[model samples]
Target chain A: MILTVTLNTALDLTYRVPALTPHTTHRVTDVVERPGGKGLNVARVLAALGHETVVTGFAGGPTGEVLRALLTPLPVRDALVPTAGATRRTVAVADRATGDTTQFNEPGPHICPAEWAAFLDSYETLLGQADAVALCGSLPPGIHVGAYAELIRRSRAAGVPVLLDTSGEPLRRGIAARPDLIKPNADELAQLTGAREPLRATRDARRRGAHAVAASLGADGVLAATPDGTWQATPPAPVRGNPTGAGDSAVAGLLSGLVEDLPWPQRLARAVALATATVLAPAAGEFDAGAYEELLPRVQVATA
Target chain B: MILTVTLNTALDLTYRVPALTPHTTHRVTDVVERPGGKGLNVARVLAALGHETVVTGFAGGPTGEVLRALLTPLPVRDALVPTAGATRRTVAVADRATGDTTQFNEPGPHICPAEWAAFLDSYETLLGQADAVALCGSLPPGIHVGAYAELIRRSRAAGVPVLLDTSGEPLRRGIAARPDLIKPNADELAQLTGAREPLRATRDARRRGAHAVAASLGADGVLAATPDGTWQATPPAPVRGNPTGAGDSAVAGLLSGLVEDLPWPQRLARAVALATATVLAPAAGEFDAGAYEELLPRVQVATA
Candidate 1:
């Protein structure tokens, strides 16, 4: 089973309004809530793809309870640790008139030292039974920047392949632990390696310690610089839709391919296909099965 | 004990941001949540005034749990009924830069017939011990528009004074039940009575079956048309801060005076003073005690 960790879980709330105006009152016609965070999103897409996935993270307080309740219906297993601070909520206001969305993200609850220690213990245990682990999303407050690095080291000790997907200091620190793979979008890759070019940035990122670097070029798709070789995957055409959870879907695709022993080219092809499919989906973290099936064979991956 | 019924209770979330722009993302700097609705707001103000208050409403799902947890520290007794649907949330985005607020209010959970019956049963039991009951807020979906009318009748049957605080159809139907008092702001009064003048609107409202009518004239204070006499209470000067809960504080003041058997003029003065004090407070449902005390004697309530 693939294990995904989301330290900063959120109760994602979507409010549908007729219109959105600043400094005015809006009566939301509908509300939809779901469990959210990068890893959870990845787990959801993996579960949809018939992969067994376990989600572990800090889910506490009332929002955590709501998130857990929403997760109960999903196929993924829940191993979320309880914390003192209530989980945060992210509100996305969808304007029905203009088809625009305004998002308000609340900083998650602060995790105390004891809570972090407890999470470490729980995470280590989950890592031991996992075939592969994906560390996702931003580190919540009270967690050190080296948290991903510590987790990557623990995963290495457990003899499991680890995929680190994050940005800024966490990504930089986690890469130093030499995780099997790291997925950084164009901006994050540039910020980390200060390389204006994706190819150079991917190589710089790998030199920092990662065995492989996958750079997502948005509409262009995935570019991988692995120990085996370098390959660039491109979609059939640009897919325009809400791109909120497209990257998470790509990570799930890559992780699924890794566990299935697919070649780097085939994996990149699947990642690109899934990312495009996710972009076509109505909401974040969800992809249309038909779209994924249709686009799977159409993606092109070539040696760079 | 005073019983406050908030049929449509909400988890009131306040998000503080530097500025607000439509269709963009906002990182909320601070989050403050409290159990809220018209009745809950009134109950909070009453609790602060050292009154023994009981709050009853439909509070179910995770947001309800969060609202309940927040209410635990307050002096009000929780007698909320459980429902199948999750409670709603009302988000207020306070722009620190412009001092403007954008509000998004979720339509509350649908209350099925069984849930409504359960709430009524609970309400009657509470009314047996209540000296006065305030029926507040809108009716959630699946509940009848005459809900307040039914509740007001029940409170009268139990020999308890009832204050109906709402607007539109529910308020119109509730007034027909001859509630002990009805407090309508300028807009709501004009909507209900079709009278632009406060005195004419208050008189029309009382004729519609409310035993007494109290009109909140915003910064001008409260005007009361009661069985005793008609009086207009004006503050020393217009107090300004957050007027979110100023009306609720006025309701609390009126209820407190009613229970204490204060004369109509004294009650109007107290309500006006408390309303002004609440406007000076930093947050909703909170009043400056010092300001309330200082303004009480200074408020002018003359026969009109």
Candidate 2:
């Protein structure tokens, strides 16, 4: 089973309005909610792909209860610890007239010391049954900055392959623990390595301590720098749709590929296909399976 | 005991951000939530004023649970009926840079026939022990447009005075039921009576079957047309703050004064003072008790 961790889970709400005008009242025509967090999204896609996955993190209060209830029907196993503070909500207002979205992200709930300790125990137990682990998303309030690094170290101690997909300080520290793989988007890659070019940034990222680095360049495709060699996997064409969950889909593809022992190029192909298909999917962060299947063989992988 | 009915209750969420920009992401710096619906707001103020208040409405799902939990610490008694559908949420985004608020109001949960029948049973039981009933706010989906009219007629049959506060078709149909009192803001009055002149519109509203009409004229004060005569109540000066809950506070004052047997002029004065104090209060829709007391004696009421 694949294990994923989302420290700062959220109840994502999407509101559709006729139009968006500043300082005016809007009658939201529709509202859609989903259990959200980078790891949760990854686990969802993984489960859809017929993979056995388990998700662990912190969830609490009314919002947390709703998120858990939403996950009950999904195939992913829930191992979330209960916290005293309520989980946060992220509102995305979609304007029908302009076809644009305005996002308001609330900060995550504060994790108490006891909750963090409880999560650590749960993660260790889950890792024991996991073939590979993915640590995803931002660290919630009251959690130490080096949380991902500690988790990576623990995964390595247990002789399990781990993938780190996060940004900023957490990503920087976690990479030093030598995770099996790291996936960073173009922006996250630049922030980590201070390089403008994708290939250069991916190489610089690997030098910082990642065993391999896959830099997702949104539309352009994936740039992978690994111990074996460097390869660039490009989608056949760009797909038009919401790109909210594309990166998480790529992470899911990569983790599933790693566990399945697919070749480097084949894994890169799957990752690119899943990311592209997610963008084409009508719902936010969900992939179109038919599109994924069709795009898989079309993805071109060549030496960088 | 005073009974207030909120057919379409909500979990009102306020998010504070540095600024609001179209098609961009914002980090909400602060979040605050309260049980909301026009009737709920009125009940809150009435309870704060030491009135024996009972609030009945429909609440269900997770958001409803949260709203009920929030109502637990208040002095008011909860008589809300449960439904299968989840309660709606209204998000108010306050932009600090412009000090402006943008609102997104979600449509309320669809009340099934069984649920509406259950609510009727509950409302009838509560009305038997009530001195007055206030039917406030919009009708949720699946509820007939004449729901308020039916409720008003039932209140009359039970020998309980009923006050109606709503807008559009619901107000139009409810007025024909001859509620003891109706409170309409300037715009609502104009829409109902097709008269831009406040006094004329108020009189016209009374002719349409409301025994008494109190038209709130924003900063100017209130124009009242009752069986006794015509009267105008004006505040000393306009206080600047959030006006979101000012109307509900006015409703509370009017209802409390009615139960206490205050004279028409005194009730108008109390309503105007409470409305003004709510505007002066820092929190949305909550009145400052100190300001209410200070402004009460200063409110001027005279024969129109």
Candidate 3:
């Protein structure tokens, strides 16, 4: 089973309005709620792909309860530890007129030291049953900066392959622990390595201690710098839809490929296909099965 | 005991951000949650004013549970009926840079036929112990447009005075039910009576069937048209803060005065003072006790 950890889970709310205007009142035409966090999104996509995925993280308060309830119907197993503070919420207000989205992200709950210790205990237990683990999303307040590094090291100690999908300092520190893989988007890659060129940045990130680096370049697709060879996988055509969870879908694809022992080229192809299908899907974190199948063989995987 | 009915209850969330720009992402600096709906606001103020207030309405799902949990610590009693649909949430984004607010109101939960019937049963039972009832706010989906009118007629049948505070068709139909009192802000009054003139519209509203009409004129205060006489109650000075719950505070003031058997002039004075103090208060739905007392004697109630 694949294990995914979301330290800062969220109740994602999407509000559709006729139009968005600053300092004005609007009546939302529709509201959609989903269980969200990078790891949770990865687990959801993994489950949809017929993989046995277990998600562990901190969930608390009313928002946490709602998030857990939302996750119950999904195929992903819930092993989230409880926290004292309320989970945060992210509101994406979509303006129908302009097709633009305004996002408001609330800082997630603070994790107590005892809660951190409790999570580590559960992580160790879950790692024993896992072939691969993905540590994703931001570190909630009160959690130490090196939390991801510790988790990655623990995964290595257990001989389980781990993928680190986070940004900023967590990614910076976690990479040094030599996770099996690290996925960073263009912006995250730039922030981590201060390099504008995608190939150079991905290489720089690999040098920082990641075993391999897969840098997402949005519409340009996934650029993978692996030990086997460097390759750039591009979609057949640019997909037009929400790109919110496309990267998480890519993470799921890469982890699934690793567990199945697929070659780097095949893994990048699957990652690109999944990310493209996620963008083509109507909702975030979900892939169009037909689109994924259609795009799989069409994905152009060539040496970078 | 005063009874306040919020047919479409909400979990009001206030998000403070540095600034609001359309179609951009924002990191909310602060988040504040409160039980909201006009009647709930009135109940909160009444509870603060040392009155025994009971709030009943439809509350369900996770948002409803959170609203109820928030209401637990308050002095007011909770008799809200449960529904299968989740309660709505209203997000008020406060932009600190511009000192402006952008509001997004979610369409509340749909009250099914069975749920509406159950609420009616509860309302009738509660009316027996009530001195006065306030029917406030917009009706949720699936509820009849004449829901407030039916509640007002039932309140009258139970010999309980009812105050109607709503807009559009609900207000139009509810007025014909001859509620004991109806409070309309200038825009609502203009919408109902087609008169931009405050005093004319207030009197017109009374003639349309409200026994008394207290028209809120924003910073100018309230113009009251009652059976006994016509009076204009003005605040001692322009008090400015958040005007969000000012009208609900005014409703609480009038209802409390009615139960205490205060004269028309005194009731208007209290209403105006409370409304002013509510504006002076930092948060919505609360009046500063010190400001309320200081402004009470200073409020000018003169024959119109």
Candidate 4:
């Protein structure tokens, strides 16, 4: 089983409005909601692709309940720790007239020390049963910045490969523990490597201690650096739709490739193909099996 | 006890972002959720003012649970009938740079036949114990436009005065029941009365079967028409700030005045003062006690 950790989960709300004007009341024509957090999103795509996955993280208040309830019908196993603060909500307002989307994100629940301890207990139990773990998304308040680093170290000690996906300080601090894999988008890679060149950033990330570094470069596709070699995988063409969750889709693809025992180049190819398909999917970050299967063999992978 | 009905309740979310751009991912800086729906808002303000208030409406799913949870801590009584769908969410994105707000409102939950029946039961039970009933907000899907008409007739039959606050077809259908008083903002009144002049429109509204009409005219204050005569209430100055809930606050003021047995002029003055104070208050539509006190004496009610 694969475990995905989301420290900050949210109720992702998408609203369709005629237009967004400052301080104007709007009659949102439509609304759609789903359980969201980086890890939850990854787990969702994994479950949709017929993978056995368990999601763990901190959730609280009514928003937490909304997340849990939303997850009940899905195939993924949920083992979220309850906290005192309400989970955050991210509102995406899509303007019908201009296709403009305005986003408003809420900081997720604050996890107390006791709640973190409880999570540790649950995570340890789950980690013991899991073949691999994926630490994903932003850290909630009251959490030490290096919390992901500790998780990476613990996963290594437990002999389970860990995939680290986060941005900024947490990602910077986490790489020191040397996780099996790190996935950062181009911008995040730049911030980490201070390099404008994608390939140089990939090498910098790998050199920073990760066994391998995978960078998702939007339309340009995936760039991978490993001790064995460096490679770039790009889809033949870009698919269109909501690109939301494409990275998480890539994470799911990476984890799925690892579980399948694929080579680095093959994994890179598969991840890029899956992400491309996800962009084409109606909702962001999900790919249909038929489209994914058709696109996998066509992705172009290049060795450095 | 005063009973307020919110057929479509919501979890109102406010998001503060530096600037909102279209079709791009944004990092939202702040989020806040509060119980919402015109009637629920009115009930909250009434409770804060020490009124024994009961809020009965259709609410369901996890968001509905949150709507109920938010009310649990307040002094108002909850009589939410369960439904199949989650109550809607309204998101307001405030752009700090432009000092503008863009809103995305969700269409409310769809109420099934059984849910409608449940609300009727709750409304009857609460109305039996209440001195007044206020039917507020837009009609949710699956509820007949004339639903408020039935409710208004029931309240009148019980010798209880009802204040109807709504717009469009629901207001059009509800007015036939001759609710003791109807409060429509100038625009709504114009749509209902077909008169460009608000005073003329208000007089037209009273002729359309409403026993009286209280018309809110934004900066111009309020104009009220009764069987006895028409009166105009003006504030000393325009109140500034978010006007989100000012309408509900005015409804609360009117109800308070009626319950206190104040003359119509005094009620109009109180309503105008409260509405002004509410706009200036931190949360739109909620009047701070101090602001209410400061503004009340300054509201001038003159014969029209």
Candidate 5:
């Protein structure tokens, strides 16, 4: 079973308004809510791919309860620890006329020292039974920046491969723990390694400690640098749509391939195809199965 | 004890952002939540004034649980009935730079027929021991538009004085039921009576069967027409501030005066004073007691 960790889970609320004006009242015509956070998104995509996935994180307060309830119908297993503070809610107000969205992200609940210790205990237990673990999303307040690093070390010690997906200091710190795989979008890759070139950044990231690095180049596709060799995977054509959960889909593809013992190039091709398909889906983190199947054969991977 | 009915209760969330712009992401600097609805606001103010107030309406789902938890700290007694759907949330994003607010109100939870019936039974039981009942806010979906009318009749049958505070057709229907008192702001009164002038609209609303009509004229204060006489109560000066819960404060004043058997002019003066004081307070539904006390003696009430 795959284990995904979302340290800062959220109750994602999307509100559709006729138009969003800076200082006016909007009667939200529609509201759609989903359990959200990077790892949860990855878990959802993995579950859709028929993978057994368990999600572990802090889920507390009313928002946490709502998030848990939303997760109930999904195939992903919930292994969330309860915290005192309520889980955060991210509100996205979409303008129906302009097709523009204004986002308000609440800082997630503060995890107390004891809660963090409890989570470490729970995560270690989950790691024991996991084939692979994906650590995703931002560290909630009160969590140390070395959180992902600690998790990676523990997963490595448990003889389980760990995939790290985060940005800024946490990603930098976690990279030093030498996770088996790391996926960073172009910007995050550049920020971490200070390399403007995608291939160079991916290589620098790998040199820093990651065993492998997959750098997402948005519509251009992905640049992967691994122990075997470096490869570039490009989609048949640029897929234009909401790119919200495309990265998570890519992560799901890579994890599935890794567990299946596919070659690096084949894994890179699958990741690029799945991400492009995700962009074509109506909502984030959800990909059309037909689109994924059709795009799979069209993805081209070549050594860089 | 005063009973306040919030047919459509909400979890009012206030988010503070540095600035508000369309199609931009905002990191909310602060969040404040309170139990909200017209009736809940009234109950809060009534409780602050040392009145024993009971709040009843639909409180369900996770949001309702949060609202109930919030209510636990307040003096108002919670007698809310459970519903299948979760209570809605109203988000107010306040721009710190401009002090302008952008509001997004979610359509409240759908109330099933069984839930409505349960609420009616609960309301009738509470009315039996109430000095006065205030029917406030919009009816949630699945509830009849004539809900206030039915509630007014029931309160009358129980010999409990009922105050109706709402707008549009619900206000018109409830007025026709001959509620003991009806408070309509300038727009609501105009909508109900088709009269732009406050005094004219108040008189027309009274003619429609409201025993008393209290018209809130925004900065100009309240104009009241009662069975005893007609009076206009004006604040010392136009109070300028957030007017979010000013109306609810006025309702609290009116209810307090009614139970104390104060004359129409005195009740109008108290209502006007409390509303102005609420405007000066930092948050909605909260009044500066010092300001209320200082303004009470200065409020001018004259025969209309």
Candidate 6:
């Protein structure tokens, strides 16, 4: 089973507004809530692809309860470690006319030292049963930025191929422990490597000790570099849509491919197809099965 | 004990950011949540003033649970009628640089006939033991605009004064029930009475069956028009601050004055003091005791 850990979980809410004007009041026409965090998003896509997945994270209070309740209907197992602080909420305001979005993100709950110790115990127990692990999202307050690095090292000791998907100082520190894979978007990659070019950034990320570096280049597609070689797989064409969770879908594709031992070319192809499909889907991190099938064979995988 | 009924309760969340740029992502520096509805705001203020308050209305689903959880630590008692749909959430983006605020309001849960009846039953039971009832905020989905009218009529029958605080269709319908007191901001009074002049509008509102219309004139102070006469109560000068929930605080002031058996002029004076205090206080619907004391007695009341 694939285990995903989200240290900071959120109740993601979407609001559809005709327009978003700053310093003004707006009445949202519709609203939807989702179980959200980078790891949760990855787990959701994996589950949708028929992978056995377990989601373990720190969740507490009412927002945590709602997150758990929302997950009950999904095809994912949850073993959330309870804490005292309420989970954070992320809000997205979609403008119907201009098709733009305004996002407001709340930093997740603060975790005391005792809570972190409890999470470590829970993680160690879950790692023993899981074949692979994916650690994602920002670390909450009171937890050190090197927290992901410690978890990565623990997962490695268990002989599990860990996938680390995060940004900023967490990613910088986590890369030193050399997780099996690290996924960073172009902007994040540039920040981490000081390389504006995707290929240069991916190579720099690999040198930083990540065994494999997958750089997401929004419309251009995924640029992946490993010890074996480098490859760039571009989708059939850019499909214009809300591309909020496309990167996470690509992570799911890459991780699921690794789990199945698929060839890197095939893995790149799958990742591109999934990322493109995610954009076509109306909601975040969702894709149409039919579109995914059509795009899979058309994805071009070439040496980087 | 004071009973505050919030027909459309919300999970009120505030996000603080350095600046706000539309269609872009923002990293909120701080987050705060509170149980919000007009009556809930009133209850919070009253609770801070050491009043034993009971908050009742329709609260349901996960959001409702979160709302209840947030209010648990407060001094107010919650006795919400459960329903199938989740309660709404309100998000506000406060820009630290400009100190501007952008608000997004969600449509609240839909109340079924059974739930509506349940709410009525609960409200009546609570009113039987209360000094007064404050029916505030917008009507929820599937509930009639005249819902406040029914409650006002019932409160009168129970020999309890009702403070009806709402606007638009609900306010229009509710005024016909002749609530003992109705508080309308200048804009609301304008909408209800269509008089450009504040005094004329308050008089017109009183003529339309509101026993009295406490018209909030923003920085200009509050004008109270009773069946017998009209009086304008102005604080020494405008208290400088963000006046978000000043109106709700005014309602609290009026209720507090009525409970203390203050005459109309004295009540107006207290309201101006409290409203000014609320404007000075950092929290919505709350006034610091020091501010209230300093502002009171300094307010000048002129009767016509």
lDDT of each residue in A1-304, candidate 4, tens digit only = 9999999999888787887775678888878778998999899888886889999998888878888998999899989988999888887777787666767678777788999898888888998998889999999989999999999988998999999999999999999999999999999999998998999889989889999999999999999998778899999887666678889999998998888888888888888878888878866556767878899999999997
Candidate 1 to truth, TM: 0.95
Stretches of candidate 2 above 4 Å error? none
Q: Of the candidates numbered 5 and 6, which has the greater DockQ value?
A: 6
Pairs that clash in candidate 4: A22-B101, A23-B101, A28-B105, A101-B23, B245-B285
The two-chain DockQ for each candidate, comma-separated, is 0.80, 0.92, 0.90, 0.64, 0.79, 0.84
lDDT of 5 by residue, A1-304 (tens): 9999999999999999999887788888889999999999999989888889999999998899989999999999999999999999999998887667899989988999999999999998998889899999899999999999999999999999999999999999999999999999999999999999898889999999999999888888989999999999999998778787899999999998898789998898889988999999987568988999999999999999
Q: Which stretches in model 4 have alpha-carbon errors above 4 Å?
A: A48-50, A97-100, B96-99
Query: Model 2, range A186-209, lDDT digits (tens) per residue?
Result: 999999999998888999999999
Off by over 4 Å in 5: none
Question: Clashing pairs in model 6?
Answer: none
CAPRI accuracy category, model 2: high
Models sorted by DockQ, best on top: 2, 3, 6, 1, 5, 4
- Comparing to the true complex, what docking class would candidate 1 get? medium
lDDT head-to-head 2 vs 6, winner: 2
lDDT of 6 at A93: 93
Indicate which candidate wins on DockQ. Answer: 2
Clashing pairs in model 1?
none
Q: What is the interface RMSD of each candidate, in Å?
A: 0.7, 0.4, 0.6, 2.2, 0.7, 0.8
Docking class of 4: medium
Per-candidate TM-score against the hidden true structure: 0.95, 0.98, 0.98, 0.95, 0.95, 0.96
**Model 4, CA-based lDDT:** 0.87
Tell me the deviation in Å of residue B236 in model 2: 0.8
